[model samples]
Target chain A: MNQPYSSALLENAVNEFAKLPGIGRKTALRLVLHLLRQEELSVENFGNAIIKLRKEIKYCHVCHNISDSDTCSLCSDPNRDDSIICVVENIKEVMVIENTHQFKGRYHVLGGVISPMDGIGPSDLEIDSLVKRVSEGGIQEIILALSATMEGDTTNFYIFRKLAPHNIKISILARGVSVGDELEYTDEITLGRSIINRMPFNETFKP
Target chain B: MNQPYSSALLENAVNEFAKLPGIGRKTALRLVLHLLRQEELSVENFGNAIIKLRKEIKYCHVCHNISDSDTCSLCSDPNRDDSIICVVENIKEVMVIENTHQFKGRYHVLGGVISPMDGIGPSDLEIDSLVKRVSEGGIQEIILALSATMEGDTTNFYIFRKLAPHNIKISILARGVSVGDELEYTDEITLGRSIINRMPFNETFKP
Candidate 1:
């Protein structure tokens, strides 16, 4: 239904909210109305937060991850391993990996994978910078922690080929049933891969 | 899970977005990322629209609906019936009624209903203004078009008693099965009410 918003200002705000992903006009209206009820300073702070982030946000010069300074905190931290680099698609993946606390290596954010369907190529990503980082030498291992999708596989293969001549170890995330998944419910490919790449019984069993 | 956002700016924006109703941290991150991908000018416009709206929006002095000016377009329009007023809970109800293309009378927005559970009373709403408007004379009828909840009924009764002194005709919206609702699926209370308040066959029948 066409909303006859009594105020043009209200309509404009709603339109702006509706432009966001997954927010429709009805929900946009609800969000706008909620904001309208808030204290003016709080709403101003909300608006300014978004504007300031877009205007002043920086990217890590080394890894291409979003950063507050020229070099991101993750890349500059002395405790993180400088010899191994974990490669991922974007800043979000970096956050997820960091939360896991399993990988202590520095990150190499590719920005995005090679998805030709969306017209994204290797040049569109930070692949050249990744190669440069590897060529500069000290990184002994490159961990390719990308998605399990076809595009992720294609990108992983491409990156592997590019870094192959450098004679460094290249690895991808292990493909297997999730920790809590029932063996009967596991997909054939994952189950097969889990068997093929199975660890020795003594290594996995503590008892 | 704790998100280790690489940039403070990104984290701040996501936190602000997460403050909105129904939006969680993960969804907030997605929205903030989406905004980051947009052009600087567009993102600025998004921020400016919300700020400008909150900073500049006005309320109609007569009807209390959100307006660009002191007098809303609906209250100022000469074509609408000045003798009748439709009392609604908020601006959204006014839009819903307007979209139906049925009501041509002026509207009085109550801002909210009398919900003692929420600490809202008659004084908290525009009920006093509504009573004052009626006491000033010229209004022949007042239609109570609030929600179909207990709070709505209580507010309607309160307003009915307040307007009883003014001696104007007071009415309410018809409660019945929805237009497309099946009789079997309709609740007993609604079915009973529809039966008790059944309309004259000829008055409702166009054919």
Candidate 2:
């Protein structure tokens, strides 16, 4: 919809809302109007939360995941497998893998993957910290649990080369049809790879 | 996805964002994470916009429309016809009509429609103020431009009864197949009504 002339304050609020990903002018207007109808205290609280998040939120010094304190809860928890670190593209991926309850290891968020097209490289990520963590020793393995994209491959390869000298075992997430997917609908590339890398029947049955 | 635990500050921001009309936990997390990646100054500006919007915004005394001051630009404009008032359910409708540039009159925002299920009544809206505006004796016409819903109809009837005593010229927004709509795909009721109330070809071409 064409922008209608309104009060400057309303316009400003709408413009800020429109800046959010996936929000357009119409949705922004609706959101701003909804906020206008809300109680002043609630709106203030909403604003304060965002402000406090940016002002006081910190990153885990050990893994670079977002945290309330110096170290993330997972990093500080001794029960988690610190010796087995899962390297991921971002904090969201860390959360995604953590939800599966499959891996009990700690994480190292690269902040982003290597995408030279986007001006992102190994230096732009937390590769040096990951290498340092391996150099410090006692790290049994480093799992390159990144997405199966060009950038993900680039990041995985870069990290692999760096950890090769340390003689640390490196692994990438297995490529396969996702759980609950129909075999008929599964992509051919993934199906072929999964078959080629098929584990022993007893080993698969153990899980 | 099951919620992966994160910082309390991050959770608070996500919770606040989730309070919006259609935002869910996942989308809220995405928005909060996006804000987290932004510059501190930009996030602060976003927060301040909401705070300032709630703190400084006011309603126009005459029409109950949202305004930066007691009197809105529409209400105070000398070029607008004060004699013709457009009664709408909310500020959004006012903007919608204003965007069409089809009305050169002032507006009366009812804030919301009368809905017993929602516990909203004529008293809860700006009905009393609208009656007062009509009773003051300058208004010649009132265009009831509300949604075509039960609550909208109820509010229109209620307002119509209130203004009956003032004997002002009352009208309603035209209901038909929307402009640029395909007749075959239009709802039956609207299409039937449009045909029954069809205007002359010359009259339709005038605009």
lDDT of each: 0.95, 0.91
Checking candidate 1 for backbone clashes, the offending pairs are none
Assess chain B of each prediction and give its TM-score: 0.97, 0.95
Q: Lowest summed lDDT over 10 consecutive residues: which window, candidate 1 chain B?
A: B198-207
lDDT value, candidate 1, whole model:
0.95
- lDDT for residue A199 in candidate 2, whole number 0-100: 83
Complex DockQ per candidate: 0.88, 0.74
lDDT of 1 at B175: 99
How well does candidate 1 score on lDDT at residue B13?
Answer: 99
Superposed Cα deviation of residue B135, candidate 2 (Å): 1.1
How far off is residue A91 in model 2, in Å?
0.8
Candidate 2: deviation at residue B96, Å?
0.9
Write the residue-wise lDDT of candidate 1 on A43-154 in tens digits. 9999999999999999999998999999999999999899999999988999999998889999999998999999999999999999999999999999999999999999
